[model samples]
Target: MSDANKKAIRTAIQTGIGVAAALPMIVAASGVPAALPWVAGALAVAGGVARVMALPVVQALLPSWLRTDSSASRR
Candidate 1:
């Protein structure tokens, strides 16, 4: 797969994992499931690992898309 695709997929996975880890914690503390904390911790760690593995591969293959201008063109 291309670098751009890999980067985007990694980003999406990271976002999903973060949300999964947060939602349960935001629920009623008294209603919290016994396994909620473990699930969240697992997701966070998985996402972190995926990021560590995918980011360098993507960055190395992708090119910079940003632009810089010291001054704007006179119009």
Candidate 2:
């Protein structure tokens, strides 16, 4: 509904898609021993969350010169 909520949902869906794509490779490369895939999946989800959460912090830390805005207000 709101922009913040929409952004969060978009981030989560993108992360889920990434995990879905990577999980099979992780399982195949590591050779699943029943619990290993589950463990890897958990770790992947955690990492994805951390990454998404860090985005705003990273943007804040970046120099203004390095940031870009396409809004008319920026012109």
Best by lDDT: 2
Please give the CA lDDT of all the candidate structures: 0.56, 0.62
Candidate 2, position 33, lDDT: 55
* Alpha-carbon runs more than 4 Å astray in model 2: 33-75
Q: Give the per-residue lDDT digits (tens) of candidate 1, residues 1-75.
A: 999999999999868756655654554354756467775576566657646544544544444431122122111
Q: Write the per-residue lDDT of candidate 2 for residues 1-75, one digit (tens) a residue.
A: 899999999899777756655665666687665366667667677567656534655545545564333232243
Tell me the TM-score of each prediction against the true structure: 0.36, 0.41
List the candidate 1 regions with Cα displacement exceeding 4 Å: 29-75
For model 1 the TM-score comes to: 0.36
